[model samples]
Target: MKQPLIIIIRSINFSRVNKERNKRDIERNKRSKMVSSASSSEAKIISQCFVKPKTVSETSKDPYNLSPMDHVMLSFQYIQKGLLFLKPSDGAIKPQDFMETLLQKLKDSLATALVHFYLLSGRLSTSVTDDASSYSVFVDCNNSSGAGFIHAKSDLSVGDIVGSKYVPLVVQSFFDHHNEVKAKVTELVDGVFVGLSMNHSIGDGVSFWHFFNSLSEIFSSQETIDNNIKLFCLKNPPILRQVSTGSVYSLPFSESPKSNPQFQTQVLQERMLHFSSEAVRSLKSKANQESGTTTMISSLQSLTAFIWRSITRARKLQSDQETTCRFVADSRPRMVPPLPMNYFGVYISLVKTTAKVGNLLENEFGWAASKLHHVVVEHTGEKICSEMKRRFNPPCALPSETFYDPTIVHMGNSPRYDNYGCQFGMGKAVAVRSGNNDKYDGKVSAYPGREGGGSIDLEVCLLPEFMEALESDQEFMSPVSPSSG
Candidate 1:
């Protein structure tokens, strides 16, 4: 009887062990299946795709006339380009999520944005009235055409483009809009690049930023289903005021059309130079001290002065040679009655200051600052309005003589745009750039620094030789943070 009982106990123990092993095996198989499923989902990569408006509006087809200012800008049929924003991959958000949900969200938001910016949905056309001599170009807002939206995957990483020595031409290619305002999204290995290519005739930098801000605002408010997207609508929408016949500046338009001048085919190199708040403050103080003036110079003025002087010196131009610094100042506040902040048009005037290379390089920093300040101050409301009244006209173009010259440095964009704040659910852009605008030698684009706090990023382009000289200048390089390059 004792032997039989011991055998029974052993049998019971064996059965219990068998049960536990079976349970463990089931769980292991379940986990393996889950892991395999996740791997398969993650492996799904969207190599290329196109996004179009989910819904089209009837008004999109309505014919819209270009503002006089718009006509004036048409002469520059080239693309006004910029990196809309770029954010690194969020660890919490998987690549699959980006490929699936994020892309759809972007499309939906963009479709909504186009509803308000209807002009972008249309194509350009020219119409001639009974007077054969007069011809007008207008945006055919009839929603027959849609803004371009492209999604592409690239092996290149974000670091390979941003903060690199040159603007990535491959990345810029993503913004090819065929002369229309278009947006693109390209996925890199570790991050994403968003870019915009708008026709220069459509708007200026401020208008461009406003449109982008509106798009971002709509995109971020997605959680609130009932949220209304607001845009500029006025009882008396601002008109492109006519120019008086007696204008100080000549009408830039030509009766005979001419091909756009192509600059030297030599490749231009772009370099991004960073100035921290501390560095900017030091430069400003140095300028004030050197000028021995009680009046304080602004950060923009000080930095512009320093960069102008540095470029002049780096180029090693003749002492008697003349160098011009040209930048567009916003004319909104300078209008008789300040234009509404939402006025959707180009309200800017070109302010050009010229100096002998030797005098500019030899003068105290304050002198250069003073020169910039004077040009800015002189463009008061009365002055800008007076100038606009004089030169404003329809079917006008920029003067042929106004072609870009290596001796002239053109400043584009501004630090005040707050580009770093242009976040789209993903974190803020690690870096922002003015895309192909940097293709031209002697072109400089400025953006607020990533760290905020009054820092500035100067995207400077020059001939390879001048860039080499500027990069090596100890005094010029002193203000540039090593991490920025």
Candidate 2:
């Protein structure tokens, strides 16, 4: 038996829901195109369409400019997430009937949800400065095409996917994308797969989950409060534009840099390892006690340090070679005055901590963790704003080390997202999966364990050899909650 793997997929979808049988089919065709599948067993897009908001808002009609933070992440791949659910209990709803109900509910609710998240339905535009030194990006709200929604089915069961040792290729290139925000629902033999994907530039994980939750909330509410628009008071309406002041402002990209060929060609193995709350606490306590500090090191910092050492050893890098760890910190609270929770789009600061592989491997776990803690602390709102002015006066091209460098390890996503809360009136999701949108070697996406209680699942991507070595490392493996696979 293998331990249940819960993937932290970062994905999104929306569209109009009209009940005219023939016209719905015709309109679906006119609004979106059908995608072809490679094989009979693989998932196929039966229908596709762009989803727009039900109510038009004059406030959202203007072209919305993306903030500098958004520009900084324009080159990154889209965030893709998926949730899995067993069919409804009683098996009363036939597959076709259940799917039809789900499809309509999602579409109708997504349209309502889009009223609040207008940017999802819009297109991204970029323009170069007259000096030809830089460019700016914005969302063309007026020419909206709506978010992408696709209905697909496959023969794969939960076991066929989660039971595999590695991510199957079929799940990697499952859907074709056209809109900035894309979504898919694939009905498996034993369960349903709901996926959401969005351009990284549009938002970070915070915004992504918020929009997704809103859609799910709307969809689920249809059973009772179906038409009570006033009842769906947005807890925190999203503020899409940058609201905080900065010392200086400039875009991060010299140009929207093309996708890295290295990332595309790289062969990586992904493994999701679970660490219980107790293990994390023990790791933290031991790290702090060893460092002779009581309060400075956090659970995440300690775990990160532990993994850093483990992976460096696994890689067998030379003592003198540099090993860099880069992770994101929320910039909203770091903003000069601190933006509220509803602040949307990209507002994140990437912090990097580097050390010689030998130094990291030889040092006590506390030493490496202290470096990560200090680097993250130094990345204050003031420093973040100042970095903007310094990074691109004349537009400095992004260094290869920023992303494609082999010596780099990037830790992303948080374990706090309400991933399991995406219930669509079918009770709750039994599992979660991350799609292969921007996967690469040395990437770790963290998510809250499905069983909760401070448990965390790190979906780590490494070369096949690296993964094997990592799994065998006693120091790292000891803390991992065992799985059957």
- Compared with the true structure, what per-residue lDDT tens digits does model 2 show for residues 345-411? 7777788899999889887888888888888778888998888768645333353345767787888
Candidate 1: clashing pairs of residues: 60-141, 60-142, 60-143, 61-142, 61-143, 334-381
Score each candidate by Cα lDDT: 0.62, 0.69
RMSD of each: 17.3, 9.2
* All candidates: TM-score: 0.79, 0.84
Q: Quantify how close model 1 is to the true structure by its C-alpha RMSD in Å.
A: 17.3
Compared with the true structure, what per-residue lDDT tens digits does model 1 show for residues 193-306? 566666666667776777677766766777775535343232223233333334222233326648755644435666678899999889888877776654677888889888
Model 1, C-alpha of 479: deviation from truth (Å): 0.9
Error in Å for residue 113 of model 1 = 1.4
